[model samples]
Target: MHQPNYIILQCYGYEAVFLECAYALMSLSRLYKPEELTNTEIWVYTDKPEWFDRFADCPLPLHFRKMDAALIKQWRGDIDFVHRIKIELLLDFTETRTGNILYADTDMVFLQKLDDVWNGLAPGELYMHMQEGKISEKGNPLFRKLDTFLRSGKAIKTEGTPLYDLYMWNAGILGFHSSHRELLQKALEYTDSEHPKFPKHIIEQFAFSIQFGSKGNIKSALPYALHYWNMKELRQIIASFLQYFDGKPWADLVRYSSLLQPYILVTEKNMFLQNRSFTEKVLNKKWVPAMPNWELLEKQI
Candidate 1:
């Protein structure tokens, strides 16, 4: 029998994001053995359910929680933070469901079977994308600024956890049990308080990092999944693919999408940054060949 757990995602807004959500769901099916989702339900909290009509006959049960404008606006709250909605949506579902909950960003893909990750989640532990170091570090200049900003106000909310000392984990993936749902509220609180002052995008991410890490044993989900947030420019390419295969059968999309190697793309982007030739960096205002030729992306590597 399947485990009474859940893997959920929230996708709303424009066409590109919706397609990315579709790609994320499709990646789950590309796993070995039972084609993934063998033990859990995949709940997509989205505004456009009809956009996912292609998944009607999926083997595992798919749940759609309809999200309207007002609900989304409410989730954003007074802070108007876009990422805040992620915590809110997860909190809302945990209210009714009682099992292990894994929340993922739309811009992510699975690297292994769902069981690989599922086996790691339990009641007492929490999970995020990966550890991104502390705020006081010089790795990211903005985070250094955040360290100064939070330190001045003595704004560390959670007990025993100092803001400067805490590690800022990527909030792309969150794993927890219904028993620990209260941490999501703390995450929202941290986001609302710091975002108005810092006004940086990583505020919500740090908030989740703070609360979830402080209160529970936070684990990294990077071993089983890869979040392609750095390569967001690829969204337009995904949009083109969606347009070309708009009404095609689900199997065709799956086969074609299997060619996507987000980790390799990220590696290539990093390598370019490190080994940027003088012509590419200084002389050529307009660069030469596009890495991983898009013309034949879906057809083959």
Candidate 2:
């Protein structure tokens, strides 16, 4: 059976970010058996390759690509263009490789078998994290920055496309087949050009939204994975757990940590708070129970 290729990016000197990457890999190891992931290739693009040396014994076969600091600096310029690297890395990966590619952020955790999700991907389709809402030059909080870009002439409006018709999607988890290389290429081109127009934080995601208008075949990956982007408090808790098991083997670390049940619980609670509807909150009053074995997690180390 053929397996899909997975790519993750971690650049510069954020130690917490690096720990997140390790924890993500550990989650992958915990979710799938060895034979299930046997032929799958996992690549990490990073400027600080040595930081990943500690994960040398990772159960999953890992490949490390050292990023060019000068090129990154030139592409990023003065603005905080950290997310732009994701576009560059995706373009680089799709150039030489073929077939299903799954690109994920470091803060995501896999909760179930993704074989069905991988199998469902078809050629000429692009899957994104989640569709936020339609884009707008006014009224919408997210796209007001894009409106500024349009007003400044930094971004060009596509012919026949109204600003409100273009939908914005989160870029945390992206899945595309080799046949849709041009889709990613278009995103890279926009990132290299009108990056200044986008808000420094969501430039890559906004650029992707522009390239992938309503016409783009965008699917959702929310059922298979959990994205903990911007959940700082939960991230700190997970970091503490990773630090406790700093030098342990990946298999042993995952086995002893109860497969990151506590981390998953915390993440779910945070997500529920952010996404729960008013009716759900009122009627579905039952809250997710807190992890009972916090002391056990610490004692295992």
Candidate 3:
């Protein structure tokens, strides 16, 4: 019944979705006794504390920690600048827990209590979402590089080969016990390395997948978490959850003790950088809603 400390990394523009996921987790936490979740700490690692004011009225028990923008801006690597902050934050958690760490992404919504995963946690085994592709999966430039490396004698792919699966585990949800500092540190180093000249996409994720993949010590195929890629997929999952609760309302859904974890286990955050106008122009965007008309409310009347 060790208390679990869940860490969430976020910044401003995502305040809307971030608050949604946070409250969902808090609501889910009500299902278990406080002792069951010893020291349930929600570390909101952010670069902007002002955003805390927006969520100040939220019902979740949140602890805010700000990061120095100056320190992060100078970091070099293929990992997204924001992701680097997350990695660094993990280091902080490591010192406190020594090994017990459950990392989650802000975009995720939890559907079930994670006690199953926590109770099932192995001492030395790290839990990561299994990559849906082999190393040779097309559409990713990294695969091309791995292929070239394999052909160049730098890597060998034989039967039972470690590189055979070559799957890239999603970083959205990662669970690693303490005492794996060496591996985590190595991952950080590999990610920091600019050599081998890898592609810029999913850099940290690719490195982490390789580090864990080569060791062959990962806990795969667990029904612990799901990663939704975009708003469309996210909506579908939410719809399914809503249906599962017998078409319950969103606010009422919060009352279902069994529905909290799944609703809060979100892993992917949408970085809304694209201009809304650009997206609107690309598609006629004629997906009209069949719900209550809000246009009348915007009228001059």
My TM-score estimates for the predictions, one after another, are 0.87, 0.79, 0.65
Q: By TM-score, is 1 or 2 better?
A: 1
Candidate 2: residue pairs that collide: none
Off by over 4 Å in 2: 1-4, 77-80, 137-140, 147-154, 256-294, 298-301
Candidate achieving higher lDDT, 1 or 3: 1
Question: Which stretches of candidate 3 lie above 4 Å from their native place?
Answer: 1-5, 8-27, 30-35, 53-61, 74-82, 137-146, 149-165, 194-196, 220-222, 232-301
Per-candidate Cα RMSD to the true structure, in Å, reads: 3.0, 5.6, 8.5
Can you write out model 3's per-residue Cα lDDT over 1-301, one digit (the tens) per residue? Answer: 5535464544334445445454445454545544555555666666666755633434445677666656556442344444555566666657666435566765554545666565545444567766656766654666666656544544433466555346767777677665565666766776665234443546567667776665666675236544443433344343444445443343344454243333233322222223336767576443321222223422422
* Candidate 1, 1-301: lDDT as tens digits: 4347798988889877887888887787666434444567889999998888866654545789999999999998898878888989988898888878889989999887655456656636778999988777747888778878777864654456567877889989888778777788887887887788878889888888877877666788998789888888667666766667677676666667766667777776777766878877785343122444445675563
Per-model CA lDDT versus the true structure: 0.77, 0.68, 0.53
Question: Top model by TM-score, which number?
Answer: 1
Candidates sorted by lDDT, best first: 1, 2, 3
